[model samples]
Target chain A: MKKIFKNQIALALAGILAGTSAVAGTLVINGDTSDPAPKAAFQAVIDGFEAENPDVDVVYNLFDHEGYKAAIRNFLSADAPDIAFWYAGNRMAPFVEAGLFAPIDDVWADQGLYSLMASSAPGMTMDGKKWGIPYTYYNWGVYYRQDIFEDLGISVPTNWDEFIAAGETLKANGITPITIGTKYLWTAGGVFDYLNLRTNGYDFHMALTSGDIAWTDDRVRATMANYQQLIDGGFFLENHAALSWQEALAPMANGEAAMYVMGNFAVAPLKELGLDDSSLGLFQFPAITPGVPMAEEAPTDTIHLTAGAKNVADAKRFLAYAARPDVQTAWNKALGQLPTNAGAGVTDDKFLNQAFSMLNNDAPGGVAQFYDRDTKAEMASIGMEAFQEFMVKPERLEKILERLEKARQKLY
Target chain B: MYSYWKNNQLKIAPWIFLAPGIFMFSLYVIFPIFQSINLSFYQWDGLGAKTYIGAENYIELLDDEYFIVSLKNNVIWLVLYLLAVPAGLFAALFLNQTVRGIRIYKSIFFFPFVISQVVVGLVFSWFYDPSNGLLNIILEFFGFDTIAILAEEDYVTYGIIAAGLWPQTAYCMILYLTGLNSVDPEQIEAGRIDNARGWRMLWYVILPQLKPATFIAVVVTIIGALRSFDLIDIMTGGGPWGSSRVLAYYMYEKAFSEYGFRMGYGAAIAVVLLLIMMVYIATILYRLYQDEKGS
Candidate 1:
């Protein structure tokens, strides 16, 4: 028995030594890329990074998309990995303020990302310092049924009057002009962002989201008036509060609805449901108020370095690699999204090309992240709830705005 | 050590057996209760340093309309949930007869309780779906304009409670079924000879004997109603404007959800829920103690 114990001790010592050696060059990453396309895209990025740094081993922990929103808060403080996936703009502010994420200005400087990713730099920065590297973003616009438009002899609307008239024509024909699901609440937020961005211009919209302007202000009311016009016209899908975003797609797919004010992510599922590029088309959310510079909604996705990262050196290397134009081009191509790198090449997809040109040339005002990403989390929750309520009960706009103002007073 | 143990074995033996259980209970349950109560007094975002905020969280709860809405919904849940006790009793009485394939009938009635709550929630959500659901389809067939039951703020809570009742009624039915098996037949026969039948028979003879079963059923139902988080989460996510939020779901939303950052406020809500639960439990314990003495 003594001899067997001695042998076991010798084996245990060898195992411990081997573990330490493995830890020396391993880079741990935790991300919420559980979807198939994103999972494959991230895997390719890891493979490319590992190929460049032959001696390093990358350990990636992929979390479920929804669960990761809550899991990130736990792991960032409890068992911080070298790198983690997150969003850009105000969504990352809480973590940055708490010091859970480390500043990576050095990574950006070394990567020459200041000019390469200028469009996304403002989103990735906090307090005059860059916090993370934004890799990909997708545009939000009106995705309509091209066949339906042709049947009605309706052209794409470029202004608020034409947009309302298009909806009126669709409504006259017994079709819901817009199919939006407010069950999750964030979908209503996208509609609100477009309305506010168009009605009050980008600067005022930014100020309102940042709580520099009261929610009950006249500028906000102008945005609400535009939204109320759509709601009163019965433009949205019936019983939308009962459906999820995916469920709302059914009406559009079956021709019960003609248009959907949504993000590019909707294109994939819509195509799978048999609406190909010929049947589906994209248009900007139209200019609401004349001379209100046309900004666009493009929520950016980013990767961050945690403060408790064990392998800072190797993690920095991965951040720099992720920010590269070549790396972003391949990553976004696989993701079916737009790369943040100005020099990166886009995929040869119709919707992607249309969105790329729209954001690059048409948007002279600015690019605003969707409403939830542009505001405080608590405020975003309350604001989105109010928006959903307004969509369902347009008569309750006054009460909704008052409630939002109260929440803003307390939140910010 | 052996001599002392032998000399005081009767005094110390029970403690030795209880040590492990006591340690686990305190670690998992008792300690966390106190920790949560302590946490309610501080402002912590689940990440940065905690700041002592005294009674501010509780004070804010007093003015929060959402808190009041949650408390009101919880009250509604508690009252409506008790209906399951009688519903289960009637079901049990109906199924207790010995007939052709009686066991199959019992199993069919008990099926809801056997399945998971998540499945129950999903099935009911699909059943109440606005556009193509069976409920709307039937309503439309009857020439009644279709109503989105889960989406309307007025009907949302009642709809979820109806779904919760499916499994809860099954659970109570099972409890009463076993109680009915061991029921004293002599007293029931005597009561029948007294010409007591139907409601009178159930009220006097049957119900008196089913007290033990009724007691357990009521306790479990009240506890289940107070801790109703899963159904609310799965079905509506306390949504359609958060009109169906109960205290439990509200507490979770404030502390742990994707947008929640007010850890201290969530703990305060939890403490209020605990106090409400404690009032019921303490009264039940008092009644139990009184019965013990009476018997």
Candidate 2:
């Protein structure tokens, strides 16, 4: 009888110890880095983190990239992970407003991230407080075929008139001046954002996207008129509405299309398609209104700590680690994107070098997140559809703008 | 208790047999219908607290242009999808003859119905692809301008409906093929003796006996047309600016898509679809009752 009692006591003690360890030492992270490169890159970060903090046991859950969007809503309020992957700006606003994300202002102050990660600070901040740590961002600009440009003897255009002239020259040579696919619709959103940013400037563009300005305003029409110029010129590839963004790349690769308005992520795929550095070139989307300060589009990806996190201390530690310059440098190197940390060095690739310098030195106004990321989700969906419609049928711009105005009033 | 059961065994036996099915039907179907109707009166984002808005969602649906477009597309789908029934019947008649290796032809005809709807959607998407699809190639060969079928707002609905008919026709064909097996040969012989020719014989003799098959085919086709979502989702995602949307696809977009979680609005759409479906459902029930009473 005494030995049985002793055994029960021993089991109880072990259970108590295990429960305490699980509460204090285990950190859970959920992310959607399911692609091979990003999967491996994140796994390496987890390895390094575990090695540095041997006392903590890290558990990571990887979700399918497309499915993760729906899954985040369920897990955030029901069973939150310590760290969750997300995007910056208005994309994260719904979650932040619902108080599902925990604020980490102390972590930012302790790590001096306000200075170290100054470039992306505005994107990560909501209501005067930082809600997440932005690790990587990529620039959006015009990617062109250098050989085609040389063959036509057209120098890089720097203003609206020169841009139109160059496109006309390319079209006269039996080549499409630009190729874009709006089947998925966001490609057109990128074009609309850049046009609005250049035509009315960044502040006005922000106001319009934020639902503060009526889409029927003349400023929005000015942007649409500039877009109509390209459509009327027939500079875009034919039958683009039927193709995907990836499918559109084939025309550019085959020299049928000369330029693409795209993000830095297009470089790797272009290289794989046999376009070397000498054959492929990157340039900023040229000036439209001439005096609108040059703002670039650079969408930032971030990580957050959830409000329901149990291990807040370790989660904060992970956030701090993710914010470090060296860690971000290595992470962005693997991602083939630019580091959000101002102190971090970029990979020595041609596109990354050019993008890094362009974003830091040349862009003076500010970096805005791409259209879908900057605007409310419902607004983005409606706006992207309008953009796609305008690209296909520019004559219906009035009706489209009125539709957007109605949606904006209803949604906001 | 034994004496009570013995006194009312007939009534008790039927109740015992019906218990599980009744419980399940209420749980899965009947309750959800009521819940969706209730949800239509509220404003909820799926995660937040629901606010009672007193039929405001239905009010919005009246003004929503996308809703109108989806309704129009659904009507087009209903009218076009019924073409599958007659096509299937003719196909069945053509395959009814007993030649050598006739089973092979029947199997080939039934092939589409066996494969998944997703695969059907994909194959048709590739076939309709503008630059590289066989369709454009044929158009170009005929010295005609190639049309992007899915990208054109006017033709996108018809394009998706055509894809849907591929499998739907095969399904109806299989149904009629089975119904053909039980057809009375004696009646065909009598019709032949009476000097009935091909069209006359089929209309007066064969069709009356195939009434059960025709009834089933029409009901299933109507149901399938109302729920035509997968093809629209896979082919165009109701895209090129939501021109190809139907009620079912629009309901999904409103409730589940990344840019939407307007639960109340989605429920409103669901209620509208249910009301339309209820019309046909009521007719079906009435027909079934009349048939049952005649027997």
Candidate 3:
């Protein structure tokens, strides 16, 4: 029996050694930052980091973007990985409030990320402390059909009147002026965010989304009025409500529609549908309240270090690595977005160039993360629905705004 | 231990056999259900501390427009979903005949049941797509403008129910088909002598024997209609502004979706839905008890 116990001890030691050798220093990452582009870009950085830091290994688990939202709350509070991928701004705020995320002040300071990601810093910060690293962000604008516009002799619109005129011109032609699908309902939000940002500017938009102001505010009604013009002009696709964002691209790709108010990420899918750079064009969502100073919708994607992270030191290293200008340059150049890192080099992709310039063009206010990112998910869900309903029936704007205001009262 | 087991094997073996299953059921099913009920009175965001807010969640639901909408949709689902049992009976009756290659027809008819509901939801979503879908093409061919089934608030729930019914009807048909095989030929022959044919024969002679199958069918269909989530989730996501939400989908949307995790409120919604299901289950079980007593 003593000999058997001795054998068990020997086997246990061997198992311990095996386990340690395999992954004692493995830094686990949990994310739902999804694909066609972002996942690969993230994986590349992970691979690069592991290769450079040969002492530590890495484990990556990617969940479906929507599934992760439900699961993250459980995981973050329990078996959290070293790092978790998520959105910045109000989306990160709730988690920050709950203290599920580690306050990574050291991460920002050690890497000098404060200066590097100055624009996105506020989005990830709550009560004067940083909770996550904002690695990358993309600008939202009107991606239009250049060839179709050339055919119609329409120049890119820069302000409300020109934008309306372009829409009228596109409508007068056989082509649909704008294509959108609000099936998942965030697509309408992009249009709403741009219009609100352009009309009321960032301060009011932020105030309104945060429930500091009511949806019944007249300035918001004015933004709705701008949206109504597009709806009444017969500008949008007839059955957009039935389609996903990808399905909405069918009309634009075939030149039946001329424009879409979407983000830079949509470029990859648009390219896949057989439209190249020469066929496409980029323009800022035209100014409405002409001097509102063109606040763009630029949602930053962030990575958080969990307070429950087993490998805090290694996760900090990864966060610092991700925040580095050289890493941001490589990651964003591959994904084709403007990096948050100030010193990061950018790609020569024309849309990316125009997007960078558009966001940086010394407009009075900088940028607002789009509706879903700017507000709580509950508010955003109701708001997106109201936006959809507004698109279909702008006459019900009063009722819709009243309903939204009621929800804001309840939720916030 | 070996000698003790050998001496009292019969006494210990049955419990030993049942232990794992009982352990798992209590852990996963029974425990979570009780926990959900307990959670209903407290405000807990799946991640953080739980704060007791006794009955606030239920009070909130009373005024919740989406909750009311979902409750109404559940009623519509239950009523419309009943049509599947009759439809399934008809399919089984129609295919009950002995024809050459009838096995292929059976497989084809049973195809929807074999496919996952997720796949069915996708197929139906594509089918209902206004511009690129076959349903709209057929509508256009008939010189009617297309109806965007999943997008229209009034029609969205109905569209999802139709997709759900496809698999549900197939499931019911298979159940009836098995029941039909167990149906006594002696009863059918006796009915023939009594001039009972067609509907009369099915009603009097066959269906009575198919009671066990009917019971299982109704139970499953009731459960299926209540949990008609995946189709609604995939096809519409309770949209055109939450018009398509059912109780299950609404609970999930509140608890899990990016809509925000109002766990207590979600649990309240779930408790109400569970109570509704429990009422039906109680009736069913009472009837089963009566039948067993009669036997």
Candidate 4:
């Protein structure tokens, strides 16, 4: 009887301890930190934070990459995490408009980190306030197989005529000049972004993606005409539509195809397939209108505070800590991408160096986030589908544009 | 109170027994249906305030070209999926013979149904892959140009339906196999004595015995056709320009995909699909009622 009474007393004491820890001030974070590198990068920052502030406990809710996209919409309405991982630009637009993400202007002011993230600020901005801080971003351009180009005696093309001629030469040698996989539909959008940026320039491309410019506009038609050149010339792989982006990489590796237009993130996987920097090459998509300054596609990933965030102070502190130059440099190094902070040091990697130059002030035209990132998600969807259809049948440009215009009218 | 309960037990007992089930059904199923109907009239982006705009979404859907294409594809799926019933019956008959290792044959025939739809979709996707896909490789061996079945917009929907039919037919075969086991042997013997054989014997004698199985197979096949989202999602994602989208997939794209959250619009699309499924459901129920009345 005495032992039973003692056990009951012990249970009550344990319950009290558990209750106290629950109220010990925790910053809940929902992140796609399941990937090893990202998890490590996040872990380092969290460790640093805890080392500094021992009073506060941190809770990290890690999810896999694709699952996080769907999970965010559902969780944001419930008891949302203090800090959430999300993309910048149009992907974050709807959430910002619905006020699911809290405005973190005060955090920026307190940390003075906004100046450090100035280049990436435009993507995270809505109206006047910054909704979040970006940590990592990567560039999108032409990823071509150099060995195939050498075999075909082709130099990197500069302008429209040279580009088409090079494609012809590659075709003569029995290689598809450009290989793409549009089964998932976003790869086609990357091609369209480059085409629009080169042909009509950045502002017009932005207008087109944002639904300000009609799909049937003369400029859009002109851009399609340029795109149609490659399509009609049979430059892309014949069975491109059947493959996903990863599956499409097989032909490039086997020398069946010469070139591909993809983001820098594709480099690691290509290297994993035993191809080096000499065998694989990165180049900007050639100019269509000779003097049109090249605006590059660099999509960014961001961290934000949810509106339902209970531990607001800790959330802001975490965002500020994440935006620190040393932290970002380490994170991006771990992540194998370019850090968003201007002062952050980048690792000595060739592709990332070129990617940095492509988006930095060295490039003539400023950064426009990729087609899908720059537009409303619905608008991007319509545009991507149209792009896929256009790639398949460029002759149906008029019809495709008309359909896209109608979707824009109804949706936006 | 106990004496009063005994006095009206006949009337009270049914309510007592049904109360929990009725309450649950109303909460989970019936309430959601009515809520969806209400949602169909509003414009909500799933996270924001809902604005009621009566029939606006439906009116927009009237002129939506994608809706029309999806409707057409759904019709294609519905028609093609019905072939499963006959195919299942044939497989059941083929495997009915008394032979060594017949159960193994039955299991092999039933294997596709045991696998999930997502895995089947993936397997079929590989089979239809243009460059090195099984189908194209065989065509190449025959000195013909390879066909990219999943890539062509005109053929994409049919390709997906063919994949869907594999598992649907397997499901029907299992049903028919069960029905065949329960068939009255005395009746079959009598039919044989009356000179009924081959097609006549099977149709007049065997098919009549499989009425219950046929009814279930037809109903399930129809439901499977309408519920064709997961395969399309795993395979094409309504792509090559949304050419292979069915109503369910289209509704999902509008409601939840990275495309955008147009919840009210999605609800409207769901309402249209519900109305279509309701017609078949109503016909089946009416037939069952008539059968009961005749009996």
Candidate 5:
């Protein structure tokens, strides 16, 4: 018995050494970050990975926002990267169904990643498998110019009536009540998602996208009516249809616009424009109607390994290394984003800290935002068009809903 | 034996010389056109297996409101884009003087065509900006309210076309400048002896010699107008309610943009765009064929 035990111990030690040496291959990573801060975060993580595994060589290919999406689609169909950053939800569904993305269920189990990631974010896992792990998440809300609000003697409204009153107050003070750029259309969807969630709650919002509820339902129509009210009340920037999200920021920064309902990503640009912490503030999109269940906007960013990866083991190791608390801390700090890992350190930026708190508290019940990742691409395109139409011509509400229903039916 | 080499060998050698270019044109251009037409009948999301949908994509397109909007905007772009040709001729005439700085003025006039369309879109976007844009600032100085040209539905298409015209007019100016250089000096002397001068000299004498340049200009302008995408994409992305979507932009939105990878639907839209373009292209080709026969 003693002789057998010694032989087993020797085999186990050899296996550990072999495993360590095996992780020494080159890893190819594709990421999207035109922003300098995010690029710095990704670079730090790559450096740390190379340092820990001295024998391993990492090749990182970075692309801008739209280019990244196109490159990933083309790469998956041909020579896929060992690992990539991709949106969760239906955006990843096409690649997943094509058998291009490797399942990371075992990694999740081994690393106890489920406990670290927000429980609600497991929605990213599909078909009884976890395919990717999230690194950072951001909350969507009304990012207002606090100085402008204070100058106008207005406070953040908590409910529907107060929200309208606030808009009225801003308009009366010669400021555009809110600023938004719908040239890409998705920015408008962010506002619509919050309105729908605050009006009909998370479950109903999911049902609406899944086609469980009719688009012409009373609750959906009510949300549309609320949006129309905002548009008609001069709550949005003039000529919003012509501007991009970046262009819209100029008006807000110049104090011509009082508020901007946007995502955490907008913070970087605001800060770049010299808006101090005291000048900027955030508040959850107010509930318009009573008795509606409310949830905060917590959009997530995930890293996935391709099923077609030539270096599967290396990719898995990279993903696991990325999820480590130390790596997450370094990445999130440089990126100015909140880490998905529970033990990750916090940033001193007040807006980022507030975003983290909002997401931590409200993510458990929140639905993913509309467009890009939540609804089917076909559905989202039509939905964004409909939303833009509704904003421009409030009288077209019925026709828009009916058209969306037709699109939804075709999708299923 | 020498006659055989001269006749048969030379004939075959010309074909051999032409083979590579013909093959490439057929493969890259002709084959893809046919393939896009075929792909239009099947529903594919690029990755998943395609479904044979017959005329379903076309039927769906008919009901699509955005498609209707895009079609209307395309017509508007086509009509408005033609104005660039005459505008370019006028500019070229104005700058054709033999003054000390004429060459510099000619180079300055040709500058817009050299820059990328993306840069043109960005520069124009800044110029039209409502808060601090050049246009708005000028309007403010003149005691008029700032106009958001890109945002208003009625003006957005015109705004984009105006940007397009800037580069297009430059292209036409270069064509005319080259044509003006090649005009027969003897013919101009004859017209001058006949008392033709200034506008009459241009109309009766110089304009007749400039037909080839005008033909090339119209052909290019028509193709450019039909294929307008970059300006719309960079300027508004077919927005304010998709009021500015030309067929090309709409086709792109359907194919690759957040619109589902409805490859079939995108192909269908492309087919429609192609058919509309074919009308103008066929006319140009037919005109060229006649010209060849005449020669």
Candidate 6:
């Protein structure tokens, strides 16, 4: 009777061990899936990862883009996932500084991701320690209706004067020159980043974000002046301040608006609205002044591991797989973005191909985006508000600049 | 011995019954308010250690142009939102008749309150759309140029307040409807005998009896106006360059939104907002206290 009881206890112990091992092999990811194609693409990668590691199970929790930011904060503060998608730059600095994120340096070195990622992944590092890996990036630029440009006999402009001329030409042809929604404020940032990059160049933008340059600096004033010019030229959608980015797309897709100065992500929405690849085209933002170093659109996104994560090994393995060339190609292709992986094959989609080529050949001296990710959040809030104020009442420029300077002083 | 034991048990029973509620109220409400006040005197990001910086945040607030704008806007919201009280009363009176399908009509009038603020914001945003929106379409039909209500700084705040009023008016209507149900029928008959009717009858008899509902309505509307975050967050995000920002939204932007975590500064903003709210809350509580004493 004693032998039989001992044997029964041993069998129960084996069952419990098996269950623990099975659970340990699974990885959970929290990400933003605001767009359908990107969500579907991410799911495909998850399936591929599971297929490659048959012992591993991948669980994904997806939220809307804007909703994900709030959800991520809660998740990080409480029960964090093993792996998560987050923005890089100063945005990640707080989390990294708090040791809420695991350093990815070991995995980064082992995979030699730097070789494939070019210089893009280095931006994910803080205090000389890498914390995240980038899968894809998109450039911010002018997306125009090619058909309208053709109808108006306007060529894509490479200079500021020509760009304004193009806007006038489109206007003459009964097309509103641009469609942008500033209700969220960051949409305005995309346009402003390009304007600043083209006018003041990259070093000044970096200096501006870093507090070395005041908001009222001549370089900053020039950037706002260029924006004022665009506004006065009747560029941008009617009632843009009332519209969201999706709402702004309607006019562009319907050919009522001729241009949209936005990121490559805008292609997905344009396609979703039933506009074909041929309907849209991309261009570098015109050089604001002759001989200024012209930068193309911003490139940023990161896949990070939480410091509090339990499944650190599994998370690293998942990130390594994500950085693989085929995974990068498949992911970017599905999302209509440029794969940071060097060997990732370019898509046949003309707009995407153009974006990839631009990212490869002519990307500006530096690779970071502006506002939210680049500057401290405290500064961004004030700076974005200042930008919005400048857009509405150009007369308030001096006050807005002074106020931003005050916010900068306090924040820094 | 038996009388002493029974008296002690009765005294302790009331305390026991009150303990759980009082504990919860202090834990969730009272404690957080004190914590926020303490935090207001420090400088800390959401993460990292906090450092004491007495009165610097407050002094900065004095010079904060955006804060000044937000304060002015909040005052406007408070003043404008009070219009819901009388408007709701009138709506309740119109729908209180014992006509056929009156129940359906009442429910229809409360529909705006049933929907979430996000949906309300979306609906109102579409209504104010310059090109394809219903408002502009109607204006164009009458040969008027489309007006972008949300884009112009002069009109943006009014546009947001109009959206806020839709649900606020509905809330007021429901409160008045309940008040009307409990009105003394004998008193109404007495007023009718004296040939009192319309505005005169309402002012003299019915309105005075509905004071409790009006008081509750005012309290709630003031709180709602002060806490108006969702509509502005969704519709305009206090844009056309911060023209529509209220204190709550501005506080959130300063503390949480993409800006750096100025948790200490945010707490400072919260403290100021709380002080402003305390004035209204104290007045309401004082009146309630007087009524209890008189009774």
TM-scores of all predicted structures: 0.96, 0.96, 0.92, 0.95, 0.92, 0.91
Q: For candidate 5, what is the total of clashing residue pairs? A: 3
Per-residue CA lDDT of candidate 4, range A1-412, in tens?
Answer: 0000012223323322322122437878878766677789889888998888887798877765655665677778755778889989888988999889999999878777678787888888898998998989988888888888887788998788888998899889888888888888889888888888999998888877878888888998888888888888898988777788888888888888888899887888788887898999988788889788888888898999998888888888888888888888888998899999898998789888888877785457768787777888888888888889888887788888888888788667
Clashing pairs in 2: none
Pick by lDDT: 1 or 5, better one: 1
lDDT of each: 0.90, 0.88, 0.85, 0.85, 0.81, 0.80
Shift in Å, residue A181, candidate 4 = 0.1
lDDT per residue, candidate 5, B157-225, as tens digits?
Answer: 999999999999999999998888899999999999999899999998999999999999998998999
lDDT of 4 at A255: 85
Accuracy of chain B in candidate 2 (TM-score): 0.98
Q: How many backbone overlaps does candidate 1 show?
A: 0
> Judged by DockQ cut-offs, is candidate 6 incorrect, acceptable, medium or high?
acceptable
After superposing candidate 6 on the true structure, give the runs of residues whose Cα lies further than 4 Å from its correct spot. Answer: A1-28, A55-64, A77-80, B1-4
User: In model 5, which regions exceed 4 Å deviation?
Assistant: A1-24, A362-364, A367-370, B1-7, B192-201, B258-260
- Taking the candidates in order, what DockQ does each have? 0.51, 0.40, 0.55, 0.47, 0.38, 0.41
Task: Rate residue A49 of model 6 by lDDT.
Answer: 91
The alpha-carbon RMSD over the true interface for every model, in angstroms, is 9.3, 11.2, 9.8, 10.5, 12.2, 11.5
Model 5 chain B: worst 10 consecutive residues (lDDT sum): B252-261
lDDT of 6 by residue, A153-192 (tens): 8998999999989998888877899998777777777787
Better of 3 and 6 by lDDT: 3
Query: Which regions of candidate 2 deviate over 4 angstroms?
Result: A1-23
Highest DockQ: give the candidate number. Answer: 3
Identify the runs in model 4 with alpha carbons over 4 angstroms from their true place: A1-24, B1-4
CA RMSD, predictions in order:
6.6, 7.6, 7.1, 7.0, 8.7, 8.0
TM-score of predicted model 4?
Answer: 0.95
